[model samples]
Target: MTDVRVVNEQAEQLVGAAETLFAAGVMARSGHANLSARLDGERFLLTPGFVRGLRPGQLATVSLDGRVLEGELSSVSAEIISMHSAIYRARPQVGAVIHTHSPAATAFALAHRPLPCRTEPMLRFGQAEDVPVVPWGPRGSDVSVRGISDVLERRPTTAAVLLANHGLLVFGPDSAATAHLVVAIEESAEAEIAAAAIGGAVDFPEGAVEAVRASIARVSA
Candidate 1:
């Protein structure tokens, strides 16, 4: 497809995902989380800083290096430019990235706890073990980028991460799927809290994990 067509499609999808997330109450009224889609090998589309009431045309078009190729500079998530760029650079296969400060998951991050991958939704669409929690970093800093980059580099299959005292970041092959993952991570965190309130949740056995992974691989393939 033409560049214009691709960007428009990406813009539409990103807008839809953002609105869905906001409506689900995962995204805040504040400009906390943002979504991005790979427009090409060298460029991508990022959500506007304020997404709750945004239009598709308002999203920013940026290079893989975080250069604003199009859109108002004010619309970009300048703070997370490095975070998004680093993910694309580290994982060429990743087509979209999402950052959210969903309460449940962020609660886990605040406590420096790994989100257990016990629930079916998390096991199937999220990670196999506990989701890693990266060290804390001030907003829009190199430290934040590095914290996230380390996990993406070490665990290439990682679908989500809990940024210490920050929030959650998730990516996938498409904007819609990645957005779904953001929600799934929050759900897993909520489940963990509920389970802990009782006694503790049982983790999947090593063999059970392998079976589920194998099943997911076949279905995805």
Candidate 2:
């Protein structure tokens, strides 16, 4: 069993990240999503089903295999538990995961459209030029898990994806990075949508994608 105080701190951290999302306009209902961070090799801390007004003591500690190692009777969101578990299992390097329902981004997802990578923000911060929309699947089902898993596997460089008619999913090396990516995605989607209202979003100059990718590689190296 996880220590009470230790888990409490983790819960606070999750809430802090949620606050960031809330500020960025990614989420408001709180019931719309969840966040988690790896606790150890075998487990992670997940927010209770919804956290709009949840205290720090309300989070859950879940094992890698999907067991609720620690939490109350109504802790985990049954609809999204598998989605979170699959991501953690598939991406060992990811220390944090954020599920969001940012309106601009979710609008694209709802329309089954992809997020354009034309914006400088996306080119500089994201690995993929376009954020793929996952194939539609019933929420919380194995099909949903597989749809997300497959896209992440195929586009290992991208940190975020739109869940068809669902919302957005983003993971990163830590909470800060994940949160930044979440905000970036929201902004990018907003930009794309706004530009569409006038004419259409213009693509980057030829070879821009390669140049950005090269710069990122050099910086990381």
Candidate 3:
């Protein structure tokens, strides 16, 4: 059986994190994002739908088969839960997923251009490449989930991906790591835009990129 206590604790934590982001303006008031945490092999927890400014105790525990066991007052974010579920099913290493529509990142998404790795944070995250925009899938459609999964399958090391004309989805080993990636992606997007305004930015040298990757690997190990 799955550990109910652990699932509850993780769900609460994710809710708190979501609230913190919303309060800080990382998530918009119109319910622009959602967060989820894996709960063993068969279950996960996700934020509820239309619930602006999530808080602890507001998250719902959901089975891999999409059954909701808690927090019935709110519905799951349609595309959000599916997207997170897809990733968790495909990548057992992923413990948490965060989806947000932070302004700068969303702007890039709308433009259908990948944010260039013109800064240190971008390179440090995953050897900054053009954030590929997955083709538009109808909102709330399974197509978005499939598109995201396809991209992630091809680029397994990626911590973040931009959904074409949508927003950003970031994943990591756990909630804290996923949250860090969210911040990194937003900062990278801001930096890239700022650099573009100041003239074109330069890509990090191969040596620098290698050094950063090595350092990350050592620290992670």
Candidate 4:
């Protein structure tokens, strides 16, 4: 049996994190995103659908097989759960996953373009010059899950991936790390857009990029 207490705590934390993101303007007015974390050995705690703005006690627990645990909320996000399940199955090191439709990040995704790395912050997260886009599949379909899995399998060091015409998904060693990644990606996206407006060559200096990567490694270590 899953550990009920741990699941409940994770649920509460997930909701709280969602609310914090909403307050920070990272989430849309209707709560279009989902956040999740692993619970015990075999299950995950996820935000329920249409919960609107999240609150401390308003999350749900779900089994790996996608069954909703009783007594919490119902109505989970099918696509979100599918993506998270595939990620967890493929990457055992990831303890938390965050999906958000923050305007800047979603804008790049909708355009089917990668955000160019033009600053040190972008290099700090995996030294990725461009955040790759996973091709779209029918929402709530296993195809979406498999597509994302394939990307991660190829780029295991990637901290985030953009879903084509959808939004962004970030995974980390824990919820806090995942949250940090979301903020980093949003900032990088904003920087890339702003730099393009100037219409000149713009890139982080190599020495600075290496320094930022070293700092990130220290923190991650």
Candidate 5:
């Protein structure tokens, strides 16, 4: 079991992230979302149910293999254990995963189209390619998990994906980065759709993403 202090810290981060999403106006109307953060190699801390009004005590500690190690796992939260686990297994560097029915991003998922990188934030956040959409499957089913796993395996550089007819899923090194990604992608989607009224959103040139990366590297260096 991970230490109680560590679990609480991670849970706090999840709570803050959920609030941030809500504040950004990207969270689903139902306020239902699942968030998790890696506690170590074997375990993670997860929100047990709805993300709105989430608190540290409402979290559960689950092993990477999907065992609920501490706290409580609601049936709803339990159902998605495998879904979150699939990402951790496929990408060892990812420390947190968040799933939400954010409107604009979910619009792309509903349309079965990838969210193209049409804004600088999309490129700044490591989204060099269009965010892929995983075909719809029963939520938390092996088929659904497999589709997510397949996309993660195939798109190693993408930080997020659209779950067809469902919602958006974002993962990163921590809850903060993942939350920021959800906002960035959702805002970009909203902007692109609005642009369609006059003229369609224009995509970055072929080397734009690479150029941004190089510039960031140089500044950091």
Candidate 6:
């Protein structure tokens, strides 16, 4: 069993991230979102209800096998158990997963279109290929889980994907990166849409992604 204090700490992180996303205008019109972080290889802590105004006690501890190990999961949250679990199983290195309906990104999702990797933020975050769109499926169904897992498997470098006619799904090595990726993707999507009014957004020159990667390596060094 994971320590209660540790579980609460993860919950607190979700709460803080929720606040940040809300302030950044990423939450859906209904203020609904879900976030989770791995507690261990065996289980994770998930947001149990609406993201806005979330509290730590309102979290659910779920086993990777899909069991509710602790706390109560709201009905809506219950449905997404498989959706998030699939990501953990497919990408063992991922420490966090977030789902949101940020408007601009959802517009791309709604249109079943991928968000092009034309913006610097997208390249900086390693999104060289356009953010792929997962085919629509019934929420939490095997089909939905399969769609998400398959896309992640095919695009190993992508940190985010648009859920067809639904919203956005993002995962990363940690909560902060996952949150930041969602924001960057949404901003990029908004820019892409607005840029359509002029001449449409343009892709970066060849090797732009590699250039960004080199810059990151230099900064780290």
Best by TM-score: 6
Give the per-residue lDDT of model 2 (tens digit) for 41-151.
778887765656656666777787778877753523756777877788888888888888888889999999988787766666553568889998987788988998898
Ranking by lDDT: 5, 6, 1, 2, 3, 4
Candidate 3 regions with alpha-carbon error over 4 angstroms: 19-25, 29-31, 50-53, 73-76, 125-129, 214-221
Can you write out model 4's per-residue Cα lDDT over 108-176, one digit (the tens) per residue?
889988776665655654435667788888655788888898998887777788998889888877776
Task: Report how far residue 61 has shifted in candidate 4, in Å.
Answer: 1.3
lDDT of candidate 3 over 154-218, digit per residue (tens): 87767777888888877778886677667667877787788878986777776877787888899
- Quote model 4's TM-score: 0.84
TM-score order of candidates, best first? 6, 5, 1, 3, 2, 4
Candidate 6 structure quality by residue, lDDT tens digits, 54-132 = 8888888899888898889877789998989999999899989999999999999999999998988877765678999
Instruction: Report residue 67 deviation for candidate 4 (angstroms).
Output: 1.9
After the best TM-score superposition of candidate 4, give how far the Cα of residue 25 lies from its true spot, in angstroms.
2.0
Off by over 4 Å in 1: 29-31, 213-221
Question: After aligning candidate 1 to the native by TM-score, how far in Å is the CA of 52 from where it should be?
Answer: 0.9
Supply the global lDDT for candidate 2.
Answer: 0.78
lDDT of 1 by residue, 1-221 (tens): 23788888988989888877877677754757778998878888887656777688777778867688778656236767778888888888888999988888999999998888888777776566678888998866888888788887788788888889988888888888888887778888888898988998887766887788788889889
Model 2, which residues run further than 4 Å from truth? Answer: 1-9, 28-31, 73-76, 207-221
lDDT of 1: 0.81
The better-scoring model by lDDT among 1 and 4 is 1
| Model 3: ten consecutive residues of lowest lDDT | 72-81
TM-score on alpha carbons, each prediction: 0.90, 0.85, 0.86, 0.84, 0.94, 0.95
Model 3 Cα shift for residue 162 (angstroms): 0.6
Writing each residue's lDDT as its tens digit, candidate 5 over 29-66 gives: 88888999998888888886687788888888888787
Residue 63 of model 1, lDDT score:
80
Clashing pairs in 5: none
